[model samples]
Target: MKRKLRSGITASLLAVTACMALHSPQSLAARDAQTILKETCQGCHTPEADNALSRISHQRKTPEGWLMSIARMQTMHGLQISDDDRRTLVKYLADTQGLAPSETDGVRYALERRLNTVEKFDDQTSQMCGRCHSGARVALQRRPAQEWERLVNFHLGQWPSLEYQALSRDRDWFDLARKEMVPLLAKRYPLDNPAWKKWQASAPKAQAFVGDWNFSGHLPGKGELAGVMSVTADGDDTFKVSVKGQYADGSPFNGDGSAILYTGYEWRGNVTIDGVTMRQVFAAQGSAMQGRMFEAEHDERGLDFVAAKQGSSRLLAVQPGYLKAGTETEVTLIGSGLSGKPNFGKGVEVLEVVEQSPDRIKLKLKAAANAQPGLRSVMVGSLKGPTLSVYSTIAEVKVVPAFSVARIGDGGGSTPKVQGRFDAEAWGKGADGKLYRIGVFPAQWKVEPFDDRAREDEDVKFAGTMQADSGVFTPGDAGPNPERKMSTNNAGNLKVIAAVDDSGKSLTGEGQMIVTVQRWNNPPIP
Candidate 1:
């Protein structure tokens, strides 16, 4: 049977090429049909064959059938023929390679043989069975024929959208596949298989959790708040905790940061909560534990926090600091300065010691009120000694004065230019310790117009002078001082030269007065 099948396949393949030569103009011109058949088709099909293709050919299919067969080969086997070549090849094959009744058996046998080899049982079986489940999962199941059939039927019916068409169109193929698959599964993945048994026995169990907690705390000027917490089991060792409560004034919490509860309770494994999934590791005492928390929803915003059980209660201590009058200072307070503790009001009493006289000290108390008074303070201090007592008190606040100018503009003169002066009292403290007063006058000057309109007039001339105290001069003697020039123009821009004193030295230093041209204004005001 095998020899006959192989021979039939060989003949059918030869006949295919023989038909191609008879029709193709390119091949027809150089080679006869027999030569094309011998070279291209004999490798796979022969004259003395019993293949599926030969059997179908023997039945005398219509022209359309021959065309379909040729089209299937071109599409499946990368037959690089143009459309016109395909039509020519198909016509020749139908005319010259038509099969007789006596050859029908050989053709049918060849086709069946080819079908068996081409319709892969392993690949199709694996793909179909693995659509909704693992291959190993299906293989591990040892079911009787009826049970297997029922399972296949259930899959086809249950997933009407997935397996219905395959089951209906290729019912025989599926049956044959199942027949081959069942025995292989029964032999290799029997119910008694150790690996299969182990997997079934060792599947992870559901998580579990325990206990409830409550917290009541004060939030400085924000007032009092309380929260309730409860833990529940997820699976074997995993647990989920739910927390809900409100602020002092009774506002409902919402969303993840609000009232939503968390589900991360993976004691021996991991759990996900409030979009924060975590792997949990327990401590020996079972009271303390640590793990990394991943932000499931916002993966980029993940953070880690430690959780511990004290007695029957759980405490979550985040970084602590004070938000006072727009100032955020992180200072730990001891003794009477502790805020939000029992008995203390919502404010702190700050004691300031001022110098009433050289010998006498004056005490001034500044009281800050809030929900929990003693907890927050400007300065938290501690006194170390025999008992090592700790305490915090308000520190004396210093006020630094800032300087401001009162006016600035042109001092009308022969130069008809820009000039202005600043208020001495507003200038504030200088390096001399005492409040210093300073003034500036036009020592030198020049002027430019508001627009390029004045640049057109080359004869227009303007000039003035300006003077300023040494206090207003920048600290360093860096030459390119921008403030030195009162105005600018294309007249190579104005230049200011400080006057020489009686000693024939430049008066550019210390408490000295120097004069230079300042600037000019056109069309002086009345």
Candidate 2:
């Protein structure tokens, strides 16, 4: 199995590829997809005893995973195929061998391009398999013990230095990987499962996502935003998408795009707004959808989004859910089937109804100076669980990501600079003296040396500059800078600071930021 999968390949040369978007399988297209896969993969992934492709049929993975497999074949092996046929093969294999929703629970971050995540796993899997890449790459697949063992041998063969690596040199890596890791992985992530069987028999159709959807999300640099996403059926398992929304700062966030659904629930969209193109990756389930919308060029800059279908009575979230005591402001509730009177709990009064629709409702609400200061549930008709916070003062301010990394690039180079985005999360002390979240608040941003080493190296002066209004830290150019003491380029360690004015005092929050170099080996799932 290892030889069949790794034929004519080096581990270092298995480059990543673009993700896949699939159409519903028809008899004719299905045959074509299978023929393409067989013609391209049969050379090395030869027929097995059961007449199945040896290595390919023994495992299951995500669409991104499947794409990576094919990409490795193209990059290392001598497989020659057209772009359309490759796309067809990917769609076919992913639809047939994709993991069920439950199996993908903790590993979706890999597919979402959230590369900054820190993963914690058991020692056996982490050191043996994921020392060179993300542990998520391992968790995103399902294989029997035989396949897992073969994969271990392939790693040893393709990368001859596997035994000389740090973790390998410390232990019997090959022996442990074959004997212990194989059984452990097979037991933990077996190829055949009840969930996959059920999903294959009754998967949701792409047409289920048609019509309008009310969504809410928090962009790292841009505060909270609420919007309406309109998805129209453009073809089989594809959509024409458009979104119109406003940030908490009143800036417009609108876009027009097209989307293609893969494996029923994987929704991928490419949208252009004011000429800038962005991509949206979402998972549609029931009457709700959740995902990320990111810049096509800078995938690191994106939003965490959640939305509800226009017909459901589900109350998703309250926009600007926090209100200052003694102030009246217009707040919007994002959801579906909104109706009846709006309730802001006690000590708060609904001044006037600004707008109303099945998707969203806007109202002028006032919180009295002596109002209860705490989290209160906001209910409307049958919608009963969303909360609103009334705060008299902010007790503390915390940066969203306590630690992050920013890369230097784009000095007329291919890789763009990865910005370190942040949001100032406010916390208020309620009457009970317990602290509760007051959502994201406006703040002034700056950077400073995090420690004596950073100060001595003048990291604050050389690493990057922070955007005052937007908590965005843009790193300096790629390559070494002659101005530095050691000519070490812009890479440095610094502290991100966000200062929020609360009542009469300034509340500050500090987070660590590491300015680093470009990521040259960016895989599809990394």
Candidate 2 stretches greater than 4 Å from native: 1-17, 20-31, 49-51, 430-434
Q: Write candidate 2's Cα lDDT for 210-255 as tens digits.
A: 9999899988877788888999998786688999988877899888
| Candidate number with greatest lDDT | 2
- The TM-score values for the models, in the order shown, are 0.19, 0.91
Candidate 2 colliding pairs:
none
- Residue 180 in model 2: lDDT: 89
Q: Report the lDDT of model 1 for residue 11.
A: 39
**Candidates in order: C-alpha RMSD to true structure:** 36.4, 4.0
